[model samples]
Target chain A: MKRRTEVVLAGLGGQGLILIGKILGEAAAIYEGKNSVQTQSYGVASRGGFSKSEVVISSEEIAYPEVLDPDVVLTLSQQAYDLYKNKVRKDCWLIYDSDTITGEGVSDKEFGFPITTVAVELRNTRILNMIALGILVKLTGIVSVESILRSLEKNIPSQFRDVNLRAFQRGLEMS
Target chain B: MHDRIKFLQGNEACVEGALTAGASFYAGYPITPSSEIAELASIRLPAVGGVFIQMEDEIASMAALVGASMAGAKAFTATSGPGFSLMQENIGLAIMTEAPCVIINVQRSGPSTGLATKPAQADVMQARWGTHGDHAIIVLSPASVQECYELMIQAFNFAEEFRTPVIFLSDEIVGHMREKVILRDDIPIVNRKFPKVDPPEYRPYQPGEDGVPPLAYFGSDYIFHASSSMHDETGYPNNVPDNAEKVIKRLYKKIYDHRDEIIITKEYETEDAEIILVSFGASARSAREAVYILRESGYKAGLLQLNTLWPFPDEKVRQLADRAKFMVVPEMNLGQIISEVKRVVEARIPVYGVNKVNGEIITPYEILGKIKEVF
Candidate 1:
């Protein structure tokens, strides 16, 4: 049987969910030599509308690109949590930002991290997705931290790379 | 672990393929789901000393493409459904004038702007007959990012080789999705055949033995006239009935004579298939998954994925129909390609359609349900 991991990163449109999703897929595909596909959907509104990116990493060829049942989900907004809370399997790992979302009755395998609060402390709220990414990597081990760092170097602009790396390190420590 | 492996969206992959195929000019108006091609072209083309222009509308963009191609530049443009509709006139002009160019339509759902950012294969028929008249066109569809890169080169090659406009029909799902693509450096590139005759002896519309006229750029030493109106071997407007018939016949013959080379399809697990699912573009991905699920559960299912949409692989589908007991076509529109499949099958086997226009993909389970309901 081929090993596969389906991940959904959900948040508001401006929270960079798609960026983190690309980084995860790039790490799996470019660095690890695994097959990966990333797809995203967002509403019409630029900033506040629902946004989600789905990444499927597999040892075999991926025929269906969409995530039918996600093994891991990260939600940075309350609306995103509500949307995917019931869609995922019960044993799936659900990670949410405790700073903005309440995970009262979501899943037994749930971990709530203060993702945005840590980003605030790191002096840049925009790197919240990278911090959330670090926590997800630490908890699930879906991708190596070194691979993710290499992907970040290729994907992130040069001026903001230091701050984003700092935020990812902070989240790794928190996890 | 090669350095050439990179993650790329389907739209970006198309631009990379275009650049690799010696595309030196791009003129397009940005639209949702396809704007990435233009955005990336704007940045990439300048570095390579190519021209990138944001035309006033899709109409002007296509006109600019024809103009640029006539000047000996491999040119392309990207747009969606509404923009595609706007470009039909110039596309028809490109066909009539035998100007080589490429048009990438990252299709969205619509009669007219129904869903701007959603995926749809509804443009299948439009791509075939959208520009009108009794002319033949080449259209290629890609289901993955890698295919987007690979087929875009083929699209350019077909356009240049046939000296006609080729349409790269993509949908929102394939356009927006990102996947690993190996940027192979050893791709075979094809360019238009230039006339070997002197400037005075060049007859623009005169066909060689293969029924395709050798093209000469406008500003070269060659001086020739190209008009959308009916013309004879000299390429000026003749408007005689005999000239019209000869000109139109050559247009069709140039493509249909080389049909076997232009048409491409992929078949999976069809050696002993009882039921075959025929699909194209993004929905074909779902159909392939359905085939896998069905075969795993003791069903003899197979898939025939059409990578070339326009000269509709009637011969291949008909061959599959001879072997399979049943055929199903799953598309994002209300039975566009299914009609062609049914026509080719000739009611020998039961043909079914799984159609969806609700801005969501036709899932594999949905196809399985349709199969079980009929099985």
Candidate 2:
């Protein structure tokens, strides 16, 4: 298993990119007892603006908070995909929402899922981030499923917990 | 033990530290990259029977802090660039009146609201000399979320111990970044000393052996005046040349006399290092990584992370300069602290600055590239 992993979740503002990044960081830092740092950047607009959250999880202390080179890049919009697609290294895992992005010039490490469609089928489009998170855990095993579940219980409100958990479970199954 | 570990943004951690330090009053106008401090304070202060007020502007907010601190409350305010600019006048008031308070400047890019949400370290000089007149101030900067929590307690402690306004100089990147913070139950808390004299005999500005006058809170039995003018020992205006010099010199003396206690710094891998990277706030994190990469690449690079920015840590920098052949200072500003490093090194070693002002953090690789170019 990798001792350190850098993950970037990029999408339009209001897509819950930052929240998922927080969940991932909490899982590693709080639940799994590893070190982690989560830093985010977004455009001025409240919604539909460029948003990116980077999480670095490590067994040791993390020196730089921002992601220099990502081990995994997850894009939820075509704009996000376009921005980060060429920036990732050749061996990096590139995950995207197939429902919204076209997977042109695919690589073996690239994976696309109908993340929005799956969330809609789960009866809430808001859970797309959780589905993407599920795919990330299944692919990289950076953080355990149990750790993420415990982290969700702490981060998500009681009213939204059930839907989010179901979305995450479905995500684990899809990949 | 697991329950004590939590993930928190640097801004949130600062609020927790302030509350833990017994800060019972907060008044500020919310500003970007720093609103979390106010938001959390609003929720937490009232619950702890503390006071939280959203003043009309930064000027009023700073006034409220000084007023509250004088009234015996450990008070603080959080703001960004423009708001910090507005508070400069009252910061001087806090200084002149000898009211201990913490002013949190979670700095953003700015000449004037330059990039409202972006991080910058351009306020180093401003934190030192923004207010008019020559004055000594305590300015502490933190590079991580955990330090945000820990240093905030130190900020409040120094404010009370020195009886002056202490600036908690944080930048947007450090303020917004989330990381694990251990909520230690054993952190020490410091409170200002109170007057032991009778009400009639009490003189508010009369110094004890330590040069710090025991503060008398408002509504206390001590009926002494506290004014912003050049006051004598009784806290009444005495603008005589000798009296003014005495009053101002005491203010500087109270801080500088105990300079060793007020300044804190951290050295990483500098025992035999020839190349030293000096930095603070978020940029220090990058410098730390740059040191690691350089060491792995067979270069003797180390880091000197300044936890306290003001009073400039001249002696420590000078000591490090004796052993170092080259020094590099990395900052989010074009070049603020690098000048301080240069002044201390005094051309004993070649000093270089890797400055960034594009609202992006100075990455470790960028610092490494600069080291390679100069090495």
Weakest 10 consecutive residues of candidate 2 chain A by summed lDDT: A103-112
Candidate 2 Cα outliers beyond 4 Å, as residue runs? A1-3, B1-3
Of all native A–B interface contacts, model 2 reproduces a fraction of: 0.82
Q: What's the residue-level lDDT of A135 in candidate 2?
A: 92
Clashes of each: 0, 0
Give candidates' CA RMSD values in order. Answer: 1.4, 1.4
Cand. 2: chain B TM-score: 0.98
Clashing pairs in 2: none
Q: What is the lDDT of residue A84 in candidate 2?
A: 83
What C-alpha lDDT does candidate 1 achieve relative to the native structure? 0.92
Residue range B21-59, candidate 2, lDDT tens digits: 999999999999899999999999999999999999999
Give the RMSD in angstroms, all C-alphas superposed, for model 2: 1.4
TM-score of 1: 0.98
Best by lDDT: 1
Pick the DockQ winner. 2
